[model samples]
Target: MLIFTNNLSENRNVFIIFLLLFYSCQGEAENKLLEVIKVKELKIKPEVLTIPNPPYVHLIESDSGQYLFYLNPNSKSLQFMNMEDGKVANEIILEYDGPNSMSRRSGIAGLENDKVWTTFRPHAIAYFNYKAEIQFKKDIPSGEVDITYVGSSFQKGLHQYGDKVFGMQPLFMNHHGMNKDDIQKHSLVYSYDMVSDQTKWYDVYYAKDYWDSGKKLSNFSWVRREDKLYIAPWYDHEIQVFDMQKEQVTIKVEAKSDHINSFYYVNEIPGTHEEGLLNILNNDLYGIILYDKYRDCFYRFFYPGFTDDEEYAIDKLWMLRNSRPFTGVMVLDKDLNIIGEHIFDKFQVHASSNVFVGEEGLYLSLNNENSPDYDEDHLRYMVVQFEVGE
Candidate 1:
């Protein structure tokens, strides 16, 4: 009996130690979360005689190093600046008309072997050389009516993937009276081949019954990490993962948030042009999802719910589009599981188009239009890091 009692006591002691270690490790993991380390000021010089279009810096890699490519439509020039140095390393002034004409509505699509690919018009992609001359241009034939975004957004233009490039439509323009047939015929993304000029549309799926209520959705937010594309449509309270390799939506998750789930659908349509603009300014919308390659995590942002009655920057259209009064981000793991959430009680990030991922951490822009230090010429990013807790 004495020996049995001693054995039982030993077993209990072992179990207690095991639980202690388990909880300790669990707590440590919970602590391994997001941390805003510092705010990085990227005082980019206006060297190429062009003004920045704001919140639209294109990132590219070259043999020399990585560069931020900015296409100035006003000056008709493209400037390449190194990440470390705020000065422009190279500039290419383009021609508007002639035999080698580059369209005014062009943007940097891809860079390869001292040449850059520019997408102009709905159906054309032009290639420009280092000497600021158009080498050649090709028109991609789309059988159906397609929408190409002019400015910066997640689905700005076609991106190079292997021998093909792909693009996504952020919203449906005629979603007001969209029928079952319209939604059925809609393709989520289109893939284009430069060599063949052949375009293929993938029949991507939407979150369960996103438009069944006959309400229109707003713009979409997206983040592409290698083969996975994380898309957050403003209408649906969910985020989906599209697998580039499989060419299908592999995962659809509704990681419900405190504020996102409460977003009102676009049930009522604005009658006038001014009313349409007012609708955008007064509604809640889903922003972008930032992927941390270094940490293999995700940050999904959302514009908090508000009404037209709220008197916060309602007069300025640009201000309402980029910087909102209160915005929040929900942190998720690689599997898209919600772990934590943080709301900027004060004006900070330009949620519409000002967040990016870097080697050090996730960079949230501090150039909110409502911010006290808001400078139209300069750009600032707040570096947020994820580290294991002590």
Candidate 2:
């Protein structure tokens, strides 16, 4: 009896310690968030959903609400859906066989007046109309610029800054057997005005910090709200606010997560709303990959822990490269937090490198679970229905 009592007492003490540890960690997570997002009740309709096929879909809105365009890079086709009645308004097939083009590293942009733009590296931006007409093109001049991981020394950190669009170019010198390392030995940031086609340059990082094991800047998204621009730098893991008026850096805040993958500015409607998305890698393969569909969005779902041992079930198969396992989407009320999430079983979403979300549903790419190569499936993109709230 004495031995049993001693064992029980030890177990009780361990339990208490665990409870305290859990609370401490939870409290810290809450504090790290900029603000606790709050959302009202959600109403979801699960029945009204559809799935369309074609592997990848890129969506674009004119901002004037005149049209919603859908670009399918796989088939090299463009389709327009009418927002007013939710119908197929028009579509055009491009001349290029998108999949045959090995260089995804190319640059493509969409304009308001049904105009499309693409760049062919170290050169100029090509303009194409809806009829796939080559309207205007210009070649980029040789100069030092800051480049980004998106492969485009131009498109990676490029954005429209009010009256003009600004692009950054990474420094590359081909003449002297010089590589990215040598470029990093110098400065990193450059800017160009789209309207004027004028260029300006700045060193993003110091020589020491660029090559340092620590203090590397990477994976950033630029969003312009009102007159200012906010950059969510992933490797630095911080949010930087750039004031356009002052033409200087302003606010900087530490992020809540270990890393941030992507972000978008959501100000179409209004009300101090912003959202940030992150692809959090874990010690294990199955980790919580976060996303913010809207500027200020929220989602809620249960995910595997960083150290859980459920490897064989979710990790090995590579079942859904385009579909996420946890849930389809999350709804947040302005502030970013876990208010509610839309989850469906028997569906998997693995890769989100390029995804299109619309009022009708979501379009994503999919591959055969059995065959992991391009020959069998050839990157089958599909559109699935996602209904939020119940």
Candidate 3:
């Protein structure tokens, strides 16, 4: 849509780059990314899902087959539905009352080779067989530092490769606060050798001057493809890559959100409980970076933040204290270059617990609390189908 003169001034070119960056950020990055990035809505329908609970889903490949799992609060167990048939595939019923009980709030880390790993709040990891039996559980291992949180959910949890179990050690800070140097020193990734009972922590932390207080805007999600692990922190405007083969944090790509125009932060620890809750709600965050294995590309989801008095911010506080900011997606290629971005209108699609990627395209929950199509029995998804250019 833009045509330059045969020769243009340097200042003029620099000014135009930020708006249409594909042509100007760098010569190599000009890959016709914006021109080709297209998306349209699609409906999977209730018939395709046939799911028991709502969709706060995690896709996993077990020894038997591929399945989508969600925490069924009504049944008090993880219900795995067959991805192909949409029927009940398997269930992991953990006992919270028995001698070897699991946490009532057991978080799904990851499942591999019929072995499912679950984590507790403060710090704990337990391995469960497909038959709903705990093989072994471990608390925070004896360490030199204070690790209040040891594990994460979905793809960021315990990854078993070779003889070791690799996992995250995200730094969830306390009320006292931490300095920049101390925050940088804390390793956020670790690997445990199951055979030797030894652990190794990787030297990776928050980006320089990246954290506001380390408490708020600290949730992160990741996706591992082959030897490269892609990490998307809650606050950073960049994607950090950890090369498992190299055994070090390698490259970082600057994949900033175009639609999150006004970004906010919870800088100081709030005095009151309600004050802290307000700060948490009134902020923007990068969430759940997902990799589409079929397409060999990545999608980084985000919530464009708004103020307390914004027109479409729902109620005064909002949704059981969980702020439902309008969702957006940044599309990228496997090499980590920003291709295009889709910006949804306010109250269009809900955040987090709803968005996911599939073979067809990125699936977004159309069941917005404010939408007229919202219902209890039938949940719907707006499949962002990518289209080819003429």
Candidate 4:
């Protein structure tokens, strides 16, 4: 009886210590303030490009910083622009059938070796050279493994290292059939080898069963540096680092926010297209991650959730117009330690579609159609340049 009582007392003391440390860490995170060192605005005149529909833009800078490549992915075409002069340099009209045809027009994964690679709708990968010529096309091999949950889209964070490309692969047993076991089995990253024409899967660390219970879908944002691939799941506060050589998750960075809720399983919010929009607005963590080679750090960008008084009811259009207008960015060092967190006011800079970390500074693209400057005749965007400082 005496020994049992002593053991219980020791355990209680340890538990108390753990709680104190956990709360201390959380307090530090809550109090940490992100300071904006500087901000610059650049206006992009859209008339210089030729595309019927609005294009999804990605900024890629050359190593020498002399040229900036603007990869514009449209529904039926992929256009390349030189940001130096805001002019279309080359373009490829994507087709469904032909020698250089794609299964479907998706988005560009990443650019390397002067070639832009895209994830074809359903299950394929295609590469286009600088001259907008299709150079390589191959279907990603799934073998007997089921990949139906991914539907026809690939999540952001397409990365190229040597002869291989890495991106997220969502695994599900159908939305209606998912359970805790299925969610625990979710592996959200995959690699495609250009030479072998094969696809391989990598497992994420700290598998939390939020998706299975909530009937929610999963999305990911990624950043690749050298031999490491950094992955951030849309709904979770953690950022995972996967080592390419080991083919395993080697590090996990958790950046907890006081405004966000801990993992919980609510009944899947269901609607038409509005359902997808609602889920993202309610559940997403920092949705995109960018590596700043110049700053030797990483930036994770995401929308903060709405307040209770805002409105209990919302639709696709309503959410778009009234949802939290501002977005937050969390900066981290190479080790993924949280250096700071900052918010960009919507009035000064509304939601940013894409963020590029450059030697000059951080460039953000405000691509929303609802922007005050958005004009049908011109491709209007307010580009904000941020300089990180002490």
Q: How many clashing pairs in candidate 2? A: 25
**Each model's C-alpha lDDT?**
0.61, 0.38, 0.62, 0.57
All candidates: TM-score: 0.76, 0.50, 0.78, 0.76
What is the C-alpha lDDT profile of model 1 across 1-390, one tens digit per residue?
Answer: 001012435534553454355445555233122344453456555544444334245566546776766665565677776766567788788777876666554455545568876666655666679887877665655435455543224334445677676766555646666654566556667677767767777777454466666565656667778877887776676787878778788898876666654554566666765566556656666677777655556778778764556444435655656578778777676777665566775676766664666654566667777778776675556766432223
Which candidate model has the greater TM-score, 2 or 4?
A: 4
lDDT of 4 at 311: 38
**In candidate 4, which residue ranges exceed 4 Å CA deviation?**
1-31, 49-56, 60-76, 93-96, 143-145, 149-155, 171-173, 194-198, 209-216, 262-266, 269-284, 307-324, 347-352, 367-390
lDDT, candidate 4, at 162 = 73
Regions of model 2 farther than 4 Å from truth: 1-68, 82-87, 96-105, 141-158, 168-189, 194-196, 205-218, 243-247, 258-351, 354-390
Better of 3 and 4 by TM-score: 3
Q: What is the lDDT of candidate 4?
A: 0.57
- Tens digit per residue, CA lDDT, model 3, 100-207: 476643477776677778776677777778767888666656244577666566746677677766778765454246655666666777777778877777887768
> Which of 1 and 3 is ahead in TM-score?
3
For model 3, state the Cα shift of residue 149 in Å.
2.4
Model 4 root mean square deviation, Cα atoms: 10.8
Among these predicted structures, which one has the highest lDDT?
3
The alpha-carbon RMSD values of the candidates against the true structure, listed in the order shown, are: 9.2, 15.1, 7.7, 10.8
Better of 2 and 3 by lDDT: 3
